[model samples]
Target chain A: MPSRASEQVINLIEAGLRDGSLKAGSRIPGERTLCMECGVGRSSVREGLRVLEAFGIIRSSAGTGPDAGSFIASEPQEGFSRAMAMHLLVRSFNVADTIEFRELVEGWSAAQAAHCEDSAQRDAALAEAAALLDRMDDPKINQETFHDLDMQFHTLISALGGNAVVDTTLGALRSSVLGYVLAAVKQLPDWRAEVEILQKEHRLLLAAVHNRDSAEAQRIAVQHIRGFAERAKIGLQQ
Target chain B: MPSRASEQVINLIEAGLRDGSLKAGSRIPGERTLCMECGVGRSSVREGLRVLEAFGIIRSSAGTGPDAGSFIASEPQEGFSRAMAMHLLVRSFNVADTIEFRELVEGWSAAQAAHCEDSAQRDAALAEAAALLDRMDDPKINQETFHDLDMQFHTLISALGGNAVVDTTLGALRSSVLGYVLAAVKQLPDWRAEVEILQKEHRLLLAAVHNRDSAEAQRIAVQHIRGFAERAKIGLQQ
Candidate 1:
């Protein structure tokens, strides 16, 4: 259970946010001020602030200058990913469920991207994804770099789908399972062959989206995800 | 920025989790012990522990007893919902995007529930949902109770879909938008009539799932969500 003092501090900050008194980049009160306002000691205030920081809702600076003290912020994707990764580590969630959820969301996102009404935005995202594919084609690229680019490519496609919630959820899911994914890659006997197959699938997915073939894009997205999981044996149920 | 000491403590705990040294319900080291082990002060250790508690990974009990100190736990749903709610309050995500995402996920869940392979599990979930609907039919119940039941009904459907990730995501999304939803209810001039319409829709959705009508379940799920949002004016694009 959290200390009552810390809860008080958290409640105060949350109230400030709900009332629009604290906007992004708005510097919050110092520890002393928070303590006085919330009737709590400095340690409790600090603890509450740390909790908020862990949630990526605030940023703190070291100095007493203009850029000092804690400020309200919004970086929920990092916090979401971190929380998800921790849960996965503790076995609170399993890899199979995560992959299943990812496949569904990514499939929907791909279809939506293909059906995107804004041609300019859709084309821009496709170009960015193409560039990521081009980077992945470099033979000298390591597994980690290739994986990072791969995640970025998928995230870009989801962003083009015009749903921020889906994009964030997919990004966090990818990050949560990243360790297992990388380990699986390392275990593969033919890494080059696997990469070659993945590159081909990526090209097909991109082309489908570029041509506004919603059905094909969705089909490829689901197939590609399930194929990788099967090949790497990341989330297979016994 | 979190203090370096707190970060050190957090890293230590995460490492323990990753290495299988920590399991759910296992008691973690005390603050003094953590301070010594992590080379940090007691305050830093407490701050880090507080952060973990905020993430729903640990629970602390007061006093010196068998269950006194913090114990590892798995309650990511609470943490996810809290983080999402805070982000929503800060305008990091708008209601429109959330509703759109919920529609997609819930529709998928309803279809999956209808197509569930395990008849026993599917029937059990449908029975639970029917019970919730019965409770919602209480004419004297307040809007709050009805809304809570409504959310549980939807969450149960998602669970029946057999994806924990989707279940948690939908729960968090519903909670993130709960305040606005309740406020919209307060604004309705004919709350009773609205409740009647919602109850009818819920019955139809439950029947569709119970009958294994996947197409009808999916269609009703999407329509119900969009219809509620339209009627409540919760996420309208002004």
Candidate 2:
């Protein structure tokens, strides 16, 4: 429900973006300047800037120096994650749909990783994933640490697919439900046992990708994800 | 880059959302009340509210009437689409990656539609898709009209998968690159011929789904998408 004046400001900025006049790191005009350019009041300009900042399309600072004021930004992940979490909170989309979507993307990513053409790059990625797994193996670490590493492992596997859209969307999805996931883990009857099983599945998934078995990698990816959701009774409410 | 006070406001609202106190359509406190609650100034409260509105977590109206205050909202699609488009503008993710991601999701959705257990719902969706195709086949339609129907057709197929996340994300992705897609269509050397080819593919795709040929449905979905991108030389820069 942005005002018409604010919408004009947004439209002007979007036009600049599409025509290449604006770019990441480019400085945006101040409120006064934008008000004149967009033919809107200062309040409208500020409102439009706030919307842009919330979307991570721009970053702003307050000072009288050269570095102050708004600049174009490319950090959409934070905004996307926050917005998605809010959407989930409002029940616009349910957990089961999210789990299903994640399964498809993550499974496809794993399969693609298994079939990667560059052996050197693929091996390096696998090695990085292995390192993450080793960290998860440390029994003294807290559940939060384990969960953080777990997300990194899955994100790394998706990154190996070399699709930025998949990588970003998957990362956002993981972060959106992070609190629910952590709470579910804490509620588990035997956290240690469940961790062990998750670790084992991770190892098998890595091995499938390492051995270039695309089908097996995909199958394991789907099973590992759905199994955890089922075990935690996370998305069953839908 | 929200100020500390604004961050507090966002955190408080998020907590309310998590605890079920801030359901959709619930009216948010006014700016002065929020400022006092979050121990911030009026500006900070407005900033926080703007961020929430940009995320589509809330909507506000002018005046002091009962319905004039901010209310929790669930319209995340507009914000998500705008952010994604801006991300694409800044080259955070390229067109090729978006196209690839779409192929994966849409192809899987088509296959799901083909294998759908509920024949009545499946047939209804397929008939809807067919109706869209019929509109696209109209010889007098403009490119914009044709493009709109084309997107609707793809979106409907994805909806048949019954995954809300997929539906929303696919719809956002389509909207995010809409201008670029339309421009590409206009640039085609033989627009009518290309349209004819796309129509044939659409008809065949619908037929495959109707026949419950999951494999063929998926195959056609991918080919139709990739084929158009290739023909238009779109997303070839990567």
Candidate 3:
């Protein structure tokens, strides 16, 4: 549990945010103001501030001038992604649950990419994904490089889905499972057959996106993930 | 970006988790061991450990003993929820995107709850949800309490969906938007009508879940949330 002082600091900041008094790029009240309002010592205030900073809620500076103090941050993707990835790494969440989540989020992302974003942007993103599929055909490519391309291709679709939450979220889910995924691929008895099947799935998904077939895109994405999940059969003990 | 030493710490833990060398109840290497292995100072190792602890990936202690050192954590919800709620407080994501995500996850969770899980467990979970609806019908319930109950009702369904990843993910997403959701409810022009309509929707959803109608349950969940989104008209602002 968080200490009372730290919780107080968090509640105060949340209150300010709720009231629109604090916002992106706005400086947090300095230590003295926080100490008075929170009725805590300088050390407590600093400790609370450190927690926020570590969470990426605030960024601070050693230099204390008008433009050089701690400020509430707008960029949340990095922090959220890091936390999500770390939590997924703890092994409490099983392989099947991760695959289920991936199917849900990635399916939603693919469908939304075809249906939600503006046409030109959606097409451009799909085209980029298609290009990645083309690159994956290289005979000389190592498994790691191939995996990165696969991630990049799917990340493009997620981003183009036009929701930051989904993009950041699906990205984190993918990363959490990525190590095991690569290991599974490396250990496949029929590596060439695996690559062929995965690339075919990607092509079908990309083509559906290019055609602006939202339902088909979603279906393909889910089926593709299901195929991988079945083939991987990843155990808790790697 | 994570510092090199911090990244090293993350990779080491991830590798262990992947290979089954480290596990849920196991402590990571101590500070001295980490310093030597990571080739960094004591401070860097401590910083890396702090980051993991803050993310709820690990739990730590000040006391020095075999049983008192850092160990991998099972509970990721509290930390993830805190991060999500704080980020949402900053108004970084828009209302439309939030609603879209809720619809997707809630829809999938409802479908899964209806289609998967043992019949006895599913009925029991739906019964609990129905009971919450009954409690919501009381006129004495304040808007704040009603909102919390509403959240609880949805969280129960998400958990019973039998996917821990979905359960935790949707919980964080709902919590992230909860403050604004309650505020939106408080400001509704026709509060009584809103309550009646929401209860009706909840009843229909519970009925579908009870009947094991996966598609209908999913449809109702999405439509119900969409109704709330329309009523709230929640923009980027509170």
Candidate 4:
């Protein structure tokens, strides 16, 4: 918990946001104004802002003008992703448990994506995911590139599910384990060999989603995760 | 993103914990020492500690010897629960989306509980859950009592499921909506009538778990949540 003055400032700011007084993408009041309005010291206001920053609720910019201060972030997921990753690194949150939770949410996401009403826009998005999978076939690519593409593919699936909550949770969870995943990629002896097998699975999964086969979509999704997790032997090395 | 110095201090402290240098019951390095080691000001160390405090990772004591300063918390869930609740309050998190996510997690939890192998400890936990349903049948009980029992019932199911991830996530999500649920209780036109229906649902849910009926457990669990969300009309007023 923050100090009393800090808590007061946080509550006041969050309340404003909730009631539509503070719109996303708009700058929050400056430190001086907040200190005055909250009747708190500048330090207290700064502390409150720091908490928000850690939660990925707000972002600050440097160097003058209207866009230079903390703003209600229009997109806060990156903030969340970073904070959660830091926590995961600290081992305060377990990796294996997170993967298990991931299985359930992602299974649902796959099913939901399959069940999502057909629309050209959604179809285009699914095509994008499939294309990303195809792109992952390149053996010459580095682990970082492959991981980014994989992240994009998974994120797109959750987004297609049309569940904002699942998208956020899945994104956060995936981001949290990213360091381990990247490490696992390096540990993998033959990236090309494994890539072929994984691409085949991805094709099956994409086909299921495309065919609106919810059960197969979920089945393949869960199996793909469990299968890779087994082969990768994640969390085993250290 | 905490200030640079704050980040260094956070990293140093968490590294200590990861290496078994900072036990849960032990006081973390004091501000003076941390400032010296991390090359940061006292304010920076305190700021980092405050962020960790907000995350529910550590707690500080007022003035004293070994009993004082910040200690690695034995129970950090309360801190996570509050941080999440505050986030939920700000519409930075959505309730309807959260409930939808809840259905999937809790459904999986129910299925897991039903599939849990027979054991004296597990059986006793199941029995306790059943007893809770029975107690909820007490007509003289107040809304507060019923809600507490309801919370316990759900908590036990997730716990018995034996996934730390689900338990932590469920706990935080439940705590986040507590203010809404408590308020909804007051708004209900007929608490007794609704409580009766809810109790029956709980009984059926418990029986499914008791019978090791995984499919039924999952189905009933999902339905129970959907039913209550509809009745409480959560997020409806807003």
Which interface RMSD values do the candidates have, in the order shown? Answer: 1.8, 1.7, 2.4, 2.9
- In terms of docking quality, model 3 is medium
lDDT of 1 at A26: 85
| Alpha-carbon deviation at A182 in model 1, angstroms | 0.5
Task: Sort the candidates on lDDT, descending order.
Answer: 1, 2, 4, 3
What does candidate 2's lDDT look like per residue over B1-238, in tens digits?
5668788898888988888898878888878888888999888888888888777778888887777988888565666666677777777778999999989988988898788776687778888999999888888999999988998998888788778888888888888777778989888999999999999999988898888899999999999989999999889866
Per residue, candidate 2 scores C-alpha lDDT tens digits across A1-238 of 4778888888888888888899888899888889999999998898888878777788887888989989888565676666677777776778888888889998999998888787687778889999999999998989899999999999888888888888888888888777778988887999999999999999999999888899999999999989999898888866
Pitting candidate 1 against candidate 4, the one with the higher DockQ is 1
Cα displacement (angstroms), candidate 2, residue A224, comes to 1.3
Question: What does candidate 1's lDDT look like per residue over A1-238, in tens digits?
Answer: 3678898988998989877799788889999899999999887898899888888888888877888888888565677677777777777678998888888999999998888886776777888899999999999999999999999999888788888778887888888888889989998999999999999999999998888899999999999989999999987753
Q: Could you give candidate 4's per-residue lDDT for residues A148-224 as a string of tens digits?
A: 88888989877888877688778888877776777676777876777777788788878888899999999988988
In candidate 1, residue A31 scores what lDDT? Answer: 91
Instruction: Give the clashing residue pairs of candidate 1, or none.
Output: A60-B1
Question: Which residue segments of model 4 deviate by more than 4 Å?
Answer: A14-40, A61-71, A90-92, A235-238, B11-28, B36-38, B62-64, B71-74, B235-238
Q: List model 4 lDDT by residue over B123-200, tens digit each.
A: 889889888888888879988888988989999988888877678778888877777788877877988888888888
Which pairs of residues clash in candidate 3, taking residues 3 or more apart in a chain or in different chains? none
Model 3: runs farther than 4 Å from truth? A29-50, A59-69, A116-120, A235-238, B1-15, B27-49, B60-70, B117-120, B236-238
Candidate 3, residue A230: lDDT: 80
lDDT of each: 0.85, 0.85, 0.80, 0.80
Give the CA lDDT, 0 to 100, for residue B148 in model 1.
Answer: 91
- Reference A-B contact fraction recovered by candidate 3: 0.52
DockQ result, candidate 2: 0.65
